[model samples]
Target: MTTTDTTATGLAHGWYALSLLHGRIEAHIERALQSGHDLSVREYSLLDVLSHQHNDEGGHLRMNQVADAVVLSQSATTRLVTRLEDRGLLSRYLCATDRRGIYTDVTDAGLALLAEARPTHDAALREALDRANEDPRLTPLVAAVEKLDGGPKAS
Candidate 1:
């Protein structure tokens, strides 16, 4: 029915607002990434995770760990990793210490791609926030989102 009518049902209003905000932001970011970098949101997310884990010696994470961090199913994560590996964005290697464990690490190409996509992602998020600010009803929801540490900031 009406917005007020929905809110009268209790805290469902806040949850609904958050879900709406999440969906809008996700769609905007997905579009921006796809058009600007030819990368899907999940692909970018996986690369982002690996990038953050990068270090002097080259950081890596187990497939299960990556799946958990990205909130994807194990099979889905494996497929995503395979795609990235095929694109030369990342590599999967058997762990020397534990043969059964495989580590996925970002390749130089992935880092460069991530560097390129960072601006687009940041701009999309900022635009979403700006649009949210335009709607008085979204003020609190936006504030809550702003407080969370989503990930690496765009430089």
Candidate 2:
């Protein structure tokens, strides 16, 4: 005697599919990063936020602001920042206007690190793109993701 609901099974399959997709992509990124960069995914995301912050400003961001941008807990962000700071990739300075706030700025060392890592990152992205191209089913999924990710609309 078996007890299985068709609708519930279908829903479970859908969830499993999404989870598998997420896991595969994350693992691919991890493997690619391991080959060329010293950063974990979270750390790389923080660096990305800092790079954009520098681009938008003279080159500094509040520590809290970075924590918010990266969606990390305050204490976790602080620890991550401390690690980067110790590596000379970034600096933390007392905010002159608000003594309670700390400002973070990427050092020249960080910029050089970004420069050195960009090519490997780009290559990894290209490899992913190539893999996607080889899979016909993924084309529609990619299109959907692009739309959700804010890509330009097709005519």
Candidate 3:
């Protein structure tokens, strides 16, 4: 059975339900992040991803990795980085060891914004998940999301 398969045959119903859940959560988070932080979902996500970087070896992420983490294309990622840099929220510098590679990192302002927005993001997420959990269609998915047990491990 594939994701497109119907409820009687496969996972289309589940797949769509998950999509709806994601959309709702993202929308809610976006509104919260925007109204409170003046940042878009992608921007906030980029800041959050960059905030995870460190000074240790391999702690830095290349642009492609950043793009992949934020679910944006490389060009789109570069554009986003530029926008944030203009706002003093992010900075791009050449890799110390690899001149050909550029690294993007959260600026002090970016980290500050991310720290402030983290609570809003978490609250919005919990609120959205809670609301979705009330829906019969999404209840199981919510449980699955909150569950501690990892998916079946490979032998």
Candidate 4:
């Protein structure tokens, strides 16, 4: 059935539209980053978090903290971090004060990759968003997306 028919049958149209928009945007960004930089969106997001944490916790975060920040389960975060570590993008270190805790820090290579991926990711997102905004039916949803992005609303 068509989306309009589903919406007419009592589906929440706004949420359905938002979900579709989110998936499309995510897929676009994922593909762009993967083809351009050999990075997944999750990996890029993890590196971005690390790159911005230089002033806090000595530029490192406990594995649990990284998991929380990245919205991944601890095990998933560990696996992802391990993969990045294997690639020399990040390192895991034993915490000096707390033997039970391990910290993850971005390596120089991670920073370099993030630097290269940032522009590609940003351009892909902007292109996808602009395409979404071009759809007249998505006007309100586009405005909501922009507001969430801290951008000025279209009048």
Candidate 5:
């Protein structure tokens, strides 16, 4: 299904079609992620952030930072983390200097989950990339997206 043919399908139109397409892809991947790794896609994304946090000292990242990275609200992120912690997938630590500040880190179990999920995740990503590459218009579309990314900062 092409995005340009907005009215071609009876059930889809323009942005609705785009959103539906996105939803379908996400649902497929989400189910696969949960069944294969015992982790949701959102959980995997959060774990990814934590794994990268090792360079930031304490092997942790602030909850807010993780929420932004995962595109989830603070409350939603908190709930997800709590669930993962209950499953022994991760741990949340309170910052010593600021009692109100919280950081999250991936536990050994979480790392294992990530390791198990990597292959499935990679395969899904590769499939999406292949689909994109098969479209002749993608080259110009990618060029437009790159241009819209803007150049270096103004000094």
Candidate 6:
């Protein structure tokens, strides 16, 4: 094979491995959160993100920012917010200064659920990574994920 072809194949393999790792981790977390807290991965992520907002200026995120953070489209984020709102897990309000802008926040119940589910989420992630590490093909990617925190050792 030509050098260019070899490089492309290598990139493809790397991309596939990364995607597989992400999918496995997310699925594991999803199952744990759902069984323990009745929350899907996206819902948990949204609640966690909104829980970090503060009362300071620009502390609250707009719909677009939330969408970007959650890696979903704006419309999808809105729908998710609505679903959570219906569950009393989130609430939405107009931006005080910008009538055209709106913000979403995690309700007290949402915060409580997130707190309860966090351990489950973390445990599931660690378990998934540990299992993945057993496969030599996935071990390097797992190590990279472990190094994401910039720590000397994988936690």
Tens-place lDDT digits, model 5, residues 69-90: 8999999999999998998988
Would you list the C-alpha lDDT of every candidate in the order shown? 0.87, 0.71, 0.92, 0.86, 0.73, 0.93
- Model 3 per-residue lDDT tens digits across residues 1-155: 65555455546677889999989999999999999999999999999899989899999999999999999999999999999999999998999898999999898989999999999998998899999999999999888887855559679
Scored by lDDT, the top model is 6
Local accuracy of candidate 4 as per-residue lDDT tens digits, 67-117: 899889999998999999999999877878788978788899999999999
Clashes per candidate, residues 3 or more apart or on different chains: 0, 0, 0, 0, 0, 0
So what's the TM-score on candidate 1? 0.84
Compute the lDDT for candidate 5.
0.73
Model 3 residue 113 lDDT? 92
lDDT of 6 by residue, 34-129 (tens): 888899999999999999999999899999999999999999999999999999999999989999988998999999988999899989999999
TM-score of 2: 0.71
lDDT of 2 by residue, 63-138 (tens): 7778889888889999998998898988877766679867887788887787777676657655665566456645
Query: Between candidates 1 and 2, which one is better according to lDDT?
Result: 1
* Model 5 stretches astray by more than 4 angstroms: 1-21, 55-59, 129-155
Where model 1 places Cα greater than 4 Å from the true spot, the runs are 1-8, 54-59, 149-155
By TM-score rank, best first, the candidates go 6, 3, 1, 4, 2, 5
User: In model 5, what is the error at residue 31, expressed in angstroms?
Assistant: 2.3
| CA RMSD of all predictions | 4.5, 4.4, 4.7, 4.7, 7.1, 2.2
lDDT of 4: 0.86
lDDT computed for candidate 1: 0.87
Return the TM-score for each candidate structure. Answer: 0.84, 0.71, 0.88, 0.81, 0.69, 0.95
